[model samples]
Target: MRHQDERPEAPWAATNRPPMGWNSWDSYGTTVTEAEVLANARFLAGHDEGVLAAAGWDTVVVDIQWYEPTARPGGYNDDAPVLFDDHGFLQPVPARFPSSAGGRGFAPLASAVHDLGLRFGLHLMRGIARRAVEADLPVPGTPYRTGEIADTSSTCPWNSDCYGLRHDHPGAQAWLDAMVDHVVGWGVDFLKVDDMLAPYHRDAVEALSLAVRRAEQRHGRRVVVSLSPGTELSLAHLEHLREHADLWRVSDDLWDRWPDVEAQLGRMARWAPHSGPAGWADADMLPLGRIGVRAERGEPRHSLLTTDERRALLSLWCLARSPLFVGGDLPTSDAATVADLAHPGLLEVAHRSGGGRELLREGPTGAETAVWGAATPDGATRWVGVFSTAAEARRVRVPAAAAGLPGAPDVVVDVWSGERVPLASAGPATGGDTVLDVEVPAHGVRLLRLGTRAHSGTPGPEEHTWQG
Candidate 1:
């Protein structure tokens, strides 16, 4: 039951929005079973009220362990799992994916997903087969030692049991080619390959990029390959990733914590201009709703994010224009959580506008955190988001001209609360500036959609002045 995408290359280069989907690792961890994945898929796409089709969680991914059981008991690392078989081929663990064990690959699961109008995806490491090499296994068709071909000296410092690929070696290219053939043949829509960029192996990253492109030509399917866990990729590297992958991670894994979200959003704004219709800087997965894992120390066994935190979650995800990979239990998430995460206005900002920069004012630790704004296609409208992490509620002001208006006279409507708040008075005395004052709750935000006005001003006093 090997799946093959026998179509043209147009699917990969679509002129529409990028792919959207759900990943299992963020929610289920090592305890996830085949039935749970299928059930989640059903909830997402099967029924009339299916969240997947209704809300657009179109990619159903099985992260990490597909070949063997993940770590057991006391502190497990489900993020990194071993995935290979005795015969030197990759297979899904019998207990989790029964069909994949007998050379059938993931066709059964993928077909089920396609039947539900969703795409199938899986995670993989960058190098040649490691588990098989560790067992001194032989390559499928060639007469070569897996260890001899593997660059044993090169290993991911954080992960054991695998060696980095000797990119220059013939076996390395051959191994990658074969692996791509296997996955694409099995109907993989999205492939998140680890260590291709995080450790920043230039050679492997380049080779894999080429390998995936060749596979796309061979299979004639529009497969999206994504590079994972990398940060601050160079223009050259980003171009290379774009040549191969539809999206690339601009940071390491993002948790539900606010600090991580802030750091990611701050860094991603610098890469705003690079994002386009297809290529994107992924700021990692979104940990909203009720995540099942005990992510933080001494916190709840489930999600610890509050309502404000969830809004912040959506804000950062939208502001960064990253892939919206939800890390929450789909079946049990509350309506508010769903509404906040799946807000159409927010998604339009994330996908259509490509996000904007943050204008800092005053931060919590005396450091200022302010605006996250973006210009849309209409050119007259702009999305302005003000965030305050200050000790107390602070008045956040947005200048009309700075918000992409011709003059300081502008009116903005709050997207969240649906309130139209007027801008402050404008005149030569105050430098002809229109200011919109919003009282942002401590560590909270106010998002606005600003539009230009004909001519309206409130006179300012002689001593009045506008702050830069």
Candidate 2:
């Protein structure tokens, strides 16, 4: 690894925060092709609904195995069982991406994405660019062949396809440096390398970071590095990843379940402080809109999230400071779902300065999961999600102090209704306990925006009205 001082400034050194965008892996899986990538890019670029770029989602990431596949009589490997080409590089399977036919990487595909005014991302794995080493491809500068297997000893426990790169090996560093240089040369803006965290390969993870840093220097451009699948990344590794990667997944593949969202958001509470302008902790992709997922049979289905579930998913994503990687077939999604995801106010909070802390408070009725996020420039917004979590509608009491304020909230707006339900009057509303009987439906949450009085704002009557 090059000395930190000798190296040029990191792309995020001036600003540390997450890169917001859409990734294909969460919903589409390996079925994603070059055509689908271009279509999504076109849709994102053409739509003024602000679905793609509104919520800090700028990059359209194409995740996982981008190689040619030989048809097998039987089935293929679950862990992306496919072969690479003679050049020791993963080429787009000609059948899937005709544009990349002549032994080229996804350069043509990436160029189209760039033409659409959006960035392109690629997925990779640790180790000797697997197929390249098998072919004994020579490294560009040195006589050392890139085919040498540094360490087949460490393979990702879950993924059987590739082994971890040996950081201690003689030419391991050169191998990684070469692979990154190759991708960077392809005009790939973001690289989401898998298996570094899951297999708990710390040495290789560190090496990959250094390699990316070196690649940036060699290319003289900013190619953001991202780590994936948050299942095994320890806080220690995460902190280290933050130093090198522009974004890191804080959890494994998150879907549209309420319980799963709760667990994921809970994990992010501990990782919130790590979020800034450049470094962000990703909570996986957004499974909103028309999610094209397969059932037991080969038939596909619409989105997995219901309308309410989609709202909750968006809420949690904003609260968790996760990059909003929209994973769905954009062309087929319903207009309503698209519009909901494109809510400017909501997206602004999710992207820009929305990265902040989540405060969870429990009351006699239920628990209120409050995500306080900073907005763009100088404003801070709070999403207080109150859940009954009970069999029946639970009437919960809300104290003024429970909302993280001195007295009562000058402005209590329902995020769903977009109405200002005042919780306070002029002067000091109540220094003592000003209780509110909140009726939360069974398994339902009431999302409210808590803010101070808008310069000339007056507290509405509903703020103190007990909804019977």
The candidate scoring highest on TM-score is 1
Per-residue C-alpha lDDT of model 2 across residues 252-282, encoded as one tens digit per residue: 7776566666566567777876765446788
RMSD of each: 7.6, 6.3
Write down the lDDT that model 2 would get: 0.62
lDDT tens digits by residue: candidate 1, 19-69: 567777666654556676787677677544663454456788887545546
Worst 10 residues of 2 by lDDT: 459-468
**RMSD of model 2 against the true structure:** 6.3
Question: For each candidate, what is the lDDT?
Answer: 0.64, 0.62
